[model samples]
Target: MKMKKLKYLSCCFAFGSLLLSPVFAQNPPESQADPQAQSSSSENSHPHGKAYRHKMAREMHEKMQRLMDKQDEELKKLANEMNKAPKDQKLDKVVTLLNTLVNQRIQMHEEMKAMHHKMMGNHKEHHE
Candidate 1:
């Protein structure tokens, strides 16, 4: 009976995967268009657009740097706190701090990526 149920589940999973494959395989229509044309048109849409892009990039870069610096300071503080804790209590605190650091790192990475996308003009349509 268990073997029969397992086989049925496997068949269902296979069928589900097959049904979803095409949706995953197809690219979005936007990506199919000429990227150069889109970028050029977008850049030309505003007077002084090139300078504007440069200014935006600079601001985002500065913001990213600030975020990274703050995270680093927090991590260092956490490390110091971990060091000061009693040995028996240290393990639990370490785990908590580690999780916090990991989350902050992920957030920093995402922000950096968004900044890069914006700087590249790829995010203007969605961001603006």
Candidate 2:
């Protein structure tokens, strides 16, 4: 059972890293010496100004951090409960917690996908 749990966690971590790699891999906008060039590049890349994008990015980062912290706390609590649970109840509790975590991850992924779609739509509109 412990081995199964460890394998499950390992798979989750690998999948999550794969999903988030692109977001982390993005390069920051380069500094352009020419103001006009910089402005044009910014406009072309993102309809919203650089400051607005920065603010949005910061807010999103904070939100993600908060969610992660909450998840961590919940996991810790669940772990404590599982530790104290009777052997007969441990399996059920473990299954429940696994379901909860998987559901949360799925929800988060869906929300991110929707947000990406919305952003892409806006980008298309701006370009058109």
Candidate 3:
């Protein structure tokens, strides 16, 4: 009786795998890849229409750059404030600010990884 039950469970599991395998084989889960290909494909496919190539686009790009510069300036100011955040301040608040700073750095690392991949591809294309 135990052998029959074990065999039934094994068959059921095998049947479930067979059903799921087709769906995954057609479209893989994102984890199975590093996702660089998907990002590259999607970026390329975005139309450089009027919105992307027009004067407004240029202005938008410039504005974004300016905003990034402003953010850097603000972060610098925050660093100065952090430097002066002394023993008198609540430790939890100081710790929270420091954690936020570290989190920003982690976000920057992800951006850098993507940028590095993009740059390397460009370099390879240029050489070719």
Candidate 4:
């Protein structure tokens, strides 16, 4: 009976060790993991990455606002020139209006380029 009790005690001890070992497994000692890896891991993990994205978006938003302001100015100038153009000078008016159209097209193309650049930056961040 004493031998059986000894066996039971040893078994219980083994089981206890097995259960408690996981506590240590749950967290590594600070020195064990590479510091740079830890920092980079934290940076990519949800909150920090999300904050980075938000910051990028804010900057891009400001740039978009500036571009819009420029577009508005161009639009106002185009409108003014068209309004000032006379119907009596039809050929001259046509030429001026066509030139204005070309300028507006160029402005739109620049805006598109800016938008595309911002989109590429956003995509690169996502992949990283």
Candidate 5:
């Protein structure tokens, strides 16, 4: 039981890391020789400014919310199954559900990463 709990905790930590890694992976700003030029270029780079970025962020948040809702439904179903499972099979059922949740999180992370990449690509193309 303790071993199972440890494994579950580790899986949760790994899932959290996967969810956060992309946010931390963003490229750092490069130093510019001219601050004025840098400021002007940055403004030009994002013509639409904060509003556009906020809109994109809002859309992404909606997408993530939908995905999470679906995951919640799946988890509820899994929990129901676990409750119905026999004592002898409960451990196996838990492990299976945990794997399912982990896989779902991984898929969510990948989708988010892809969406972020596409958004960045579009932003770059717009500037170019």
Candidate 6:
């Protein structure tokens, strides 16, 4: 009976230690995570002021709209110039207008991309 009781206690002790092993284990190294992923996680854990973010987004939209409207006006001016050109020069004028329009469009696209990048960077910073 004594031997049986001692064996039972030792078995219980082993099982209890097994159950609690995780509680004593070292935490996984944070360096294992991608730096950007860790940074984004930390940023997400902290929230920006809702009103401030909204206001910034609204301003950005307004600025983009203004830029688009200016582009439209420039395109219309190009169209007028092409229309007014002499018949002999019409093809050349059209080519010039098209090139100008393409360049303007490319510039606009680059500006918009830059704006988007800036906004996202600001948003991440503000979140923290």
Order the candidates by TM-score, highest first.
5, 2, 6, 1, 4, 3
Q: What CA root-mean-square deviation does each model show from the true structure?
A: 12.7, 7.2, 19.9, 33.1, 6.5, 30.9
Tens digits of per-residue lDDT, candidate 1, 10-48, equal 644554454345422535378535645566565676677
Per-model TM against the reference: 0.54, 0.59, 0.35, 0.44, 0.60, 0.58
Q: Per-residue CA lDDT of candidate 3, range 38-115, in tens? A: 345445555642233345436645755675576567667765675577644434334444455556555655654565
Residue 29 lDDT (model 6): 63
Separately for all candidates shown, the number of backbone clashes (residues 3 or more apart, or on different chains) is 0, 0, 0, 0, 0, 0
- Model 1 poorest 10 in a row by lDDT: 19-28
Order of candidates by lDDT, top first? Answer: 5, 6, 1, 2, 4, 3
The C-alpha local distance difference test score for the whole of candidate 3 amounts to 0.51
lDDT of 6 by residue, 37-91 (tens): 5455545455654556568779888987898789779768877886798765655
Whose TM-score is higher: candidate 1's or candidate 6's?
Answer: 6
Q: Evaluated with TM-score, which candidate comes out highest?
A: 5
| Candidate 4 per-residue lDDT over residues 44-71, each given as its tens digit | 6656575765687678778767866775
Q: Say which prediction, candidate 1 or candidate 5, comes out ahead on lDDT.
A: 5
Once fitted onto the true fold, the runs of candidate 1 whose alpha carbons sit more than 4 angstroms away are 1-47, 120-128
Give lDDT per model, in order: 0.64, 0.63, 0.51, 0.57, 0.70, 0.65
Query: 1-128 in candidate 2: lDDT tens per residue?
Result: 78967765675565446445553354435652343564455365774656664676577668778877887698678767866988667666666666666676776677666766765575455456
Q: In model 3, which residue pairs have backbone atoms overlapping below 3 Å?
A: none
Regions more than 4 Å wrong, model 3: 1-89
Candidate 6 Cα errors over 4 Å, as ranges: 1-48
What's the lDDT for candidate 5?
0.70
Q: 112, model 3: CA deviation in Å? A: 1.8
- Residue 78, model 1: Cα distance from true site in angstroms: 0.6
